[model samples]
Target chain A: MLQTDQLKFAYTGGDTFSFPDISCERGAHWLLLGQSGSGKTTFLHLLGGLLSPKSGAIRLEGTDMAQLSGPALDRFRGRHIGIIFQKAHFVNALTVGENLALAQELAGVPVDNGRIAKLLDRLNVGQKIHRKPDRLSVGEQQRVAIARALVNSPELILADEPTSALDDENCEQVLHLLTEQAASVKATLLIVTHDGRLKDKIPNQIRLDS
Target chain B: MNILQLSWKNLINKPLSMLLSTILFALGVGLVSLIMLLNKQLDQQFARNLEGIDMVIGAKGSPLQLVLSSIYHLDAPTGNINIGEAKAFLRPEHPLINRAIPLSLGDSYRGYRIVGTNHNIIDHYGAEISEGKIWEAPLEVTIGSRVAEREGLKIGDTFYSTHGLDINEDLEHDDAGAFRVVGILQPGGTVIDQLILTAAESIWEVHDHAPAPVGAAPAEEEHDHEAGEEHAEGEEHTEATHAAPATDIPLHERVDKDITAILVNFKARNAMTLNLPRTINENTNLMAANPSYEISKLFDQLGLGEQVLRWLAYIIIGVSFLSIFISLFNSLKDRKYELAIMRTLGASPGKLFLLIIFEGLLLAVLGYILGILLSHVGIEMIGQFVKKADRYGFTGKTFLPGEGWLFLGALFVGLLAAVIPAWQARQTDIHDTLAEG
Candidate 1:
């Protein structure tokens, strides 16, 4: 479960944003939509604990994110939250399996190859475990990124415009995979995007103003 | 996976740049190590050859030339000294002198110097006869072990002596006589290993028929038949006393004898140790040159060239460090986004910093190994050249005394070169970097 109350943030020498408070239950999926300059990505970053909210109390499972700082904040985020970037970027030098293992290591969890293999098999990318990310097709790469997000079985999943660059068919497939993977892990999912194509798929939505 | 594995993968991602940096580093280390090996071995060789001789007394010329010729036998003699004048220190009653060995150098057998001296010279070098007896008769020679092996000479093999130090067959003294090999000295790892030893009278006998040079009077002493009897009665009769065949004639009267030099070893801490050199230099026609002083001067003359080469090697090392720094810095800029992605995956700033540092350490260790191998190969090539030039083989396979310091120096360079890049990596703005894409 995730909760926020009166979250407001501002960049240096930039305009401030006052966000609407929201509450989401466990195993629920929601979309955060906004136009360009609407600070949609900034809001996602703030929720992911990558940026501090100027005035906020973000609660994830009854723990306040504002109280955590430095390494404590990083460790808590790693163990409890998973993030998917707009572009599916990977460390080009490591194999898919190694990347998955790295996610677990950074989360301070013992590496479980069995969990990684099972996640990849469920995502229909089990054959790409030993291949470098650069050698895989775009669809495979996206699936591997999704598998990485679920490797640690975090409580919340945050995706930032993950399907904006794909075709309509790939966009639908990626959205389905993201929601399915989040459901399988019993995690609350939030996707922030400017694309209106995702409006009909996810009924629960929060729209930000520029 | 681990930081080391990640660093390794990152390094290999840009194979060309990493390879270039490693090669530059290897060249720098290899040159410095080669110089250290050569300088150490040459210093050891010089010190080893100048072991026993305290002072060299030779004709009035350059003291360095005298030391080089008499002690190392690597240069031409200054000139000849009167045998009668140099004989006073050879007397057993002399107070300051412990031992004095006379050397008459004029001829060579196949580029190896034929040093005409008494048995005392062999004793001073601790050379034992390995095959045959010592030379007792004129024109009978004892070759050194290396000389015997190199020249393929054995006992009773006859060889003609050349007139000068070089191996010129045109200057061969065939008319004088063919010198027979009577003995072979054992290998002493000194200058003695390159010489052919014979009695002092053989030098005088070899040039007995040649006309003496003008303006120099060959000192001819009349034989006091009683002194000859006394010499035979008193102590061991030296080979100088038996130069003449007829008993009625004096030994020096037969030929005006001249010696090239006299190597003297004084009694330890004797009062005359200080006074003898001054007395010999200022009073006598011969000059006394200290082997240690002359060798130090030789090093001083060679120091400038060595210093310049050392600086060049250091500059190469500096350039190598610069290349490593530049390569790492450039790659850091290119991998900024990837690093930001890692941060999102829960990698801390300190871990990213260590990953960059690990890359540097890996490059340095690989370069060090390659550099040491290159230096050893260089040493082997130089050793072969030196062995061909002189029979004295250069021992370059041994590790140098300062190599441990070199290892530390390489590591320090790697650490220093990586500091800025690793700092940049640690300071990466993950939010801004990820937002760009």
Candidate 2:
């Protein structure tokens, strides 16, 4: 389970955002809907422990993320949360399987190549595990990125505009794959996006105002 | 993957930049190491042989040339000195001198010099006979260990002498009877190791019958001219001369005798003996040069060139550090997003910092290993070309103790070159970088 109450954040001498409170049970799917400049990405970063909030409590599985800092917070995030960015960026020097292995290594967990292969096969990217992220097609790279995120079997999956760069057909397929993979891992999935095509893809939604 | 593996992968990803930095660093290290090796070996050879002997009495010429020729056998002797004049220091009753070993030069057997000296010269260098007996008769030769090994001359083997030190010149003394190898010395690691030893009478006998108007002129014609002058002096002094067997006459009585140099050791380091070189240089025709003084002066001159080369090597290392810095800095700029992604994957800022440092360290370590190998190979080639392999007797196989310090210095250079770039990598703004991407 993941929950946030009145999460607030501000960039240095820039816009401040006060996010709406949201709570989700384990393995639940939620769409965090927002227009451009609504600070949806900021809220997602604060929830993922990538950014510290000005004032709020982001509790993930009963632990407040705001209380942890430095390596401890980074480790906790690695063990319990998974994040996917919009553009499906990766360490271009590593192959797909190596990227997944790096994620497990950084999390201080013993890497399981079998789990990695199974996850990629579930995402229909089993054949691309040996390929570099750059050499893969955009859809294939996105699927590989999904495998990297779920490789650690975290408790929460945070996707920030992951489908914004995809076409309509890819957007639908990726949404279906994200929910299926999240359910298999029994993880709470929250997708933050400004793409309107994903409006009806998930019934549960939370909207951010300008 | 571990941070070290990540660093390695990143370096291999951009092979050109890594190779350029590594090669630049290696060249600088190689040059500096070569100079260090050469300087250390030269000092060892000079110091080892220059021990015990105090002054070299020879013909008036460059003092350094006299030391090099008489002590190191690395150059031609400066003409020759008359044995009558040099015999003053050779007397056992002399107050200032303890031992004086006279050397007669101007002949070689296949490029190795045949030094005509007494048995005291063998004891002077701490040489032991490995085979056969010492040369007691004229024309009987005792070859040094190196000469014996290289010429393959054993006891009872006979070889003819050439006119001068050079082997390229075919000024063979066919008229002179072949000198028999009577003894072989154990390796003493001195100039004596490359010489063929005999009594002073053998050199006189060899040149006494040498036919005039030789085939090829020796490089220093003054040697032959001085020998002729001594022969002329001998004819005026005695009737029992060149036709008489060389073994029949004593060395001191033969006024026709001319020695190349005399290696003198002082009885005590008193003011009189300390001033002996100056007194002999000013009071006599024979020039006296202190071996240590001349060797230090030689080093002072060589030190200047070594200092310049060391500075050049340092400058090259500095440029290589800069190259490494630029390469890492540029790569950091390009990999900002990926570094942020690593952060998201639970790589701490400190981890990123170590990653960059490891990358720099890997390159430096590679350069250092290659550099040391390059320097030894370079020195080996130079040793072969300069004929120092057997003569001065140093090889590239030697590893100096100072190289351990050099290794630490290279690692420091790597750490220094990576500081700023690693700092920037540590300060990577994860949220902003991810948002931008």
Most accurate candidate by TM-score:
2
How many clashing residue pairs are found in candidate 1?
0
Residue A28: error of model 2 in Å? 0.8
TM-score of each model, paired residue for residue: 0.88, 0.94
Winner by DockQ: 2
lDDT of 2 by residue, B256-341 (tens): 46788989988888888888889988999989898999999989999999999999999999999999999999999889988998
TM-score of chain A of each: 0.97, 0.97
What is candidate 2's lDDT per residue for A17-98, written digit by digit as tens?
8988899999999999988888887888998999999888999999999889999998998889999889888888888999
Cα displacement (Å) at residue B405, model 2: 0.6
Q: Candidate 2, fnat value?
A: 0.70
The DockQ-based CAPRI class assigned to model 2 is high
What DockQ does each candidate score versus the true complex, computed on alpha carbons?
0.60, 0.82
Compute the lDDT of residue B412 as modeled in candidate 1. Answer: 88
Least well predicted 10-residue stretch by lDDT in candidate 1 chain B: B215-224
lDDT of 2 at B118: 85
Model 1: residues >4 Å from true position, as ranges? A113-118, A121-130, B128-141, B152-158, B174-186, B209-255, B269-271
Error of 2 at B142 (Å): 1.0
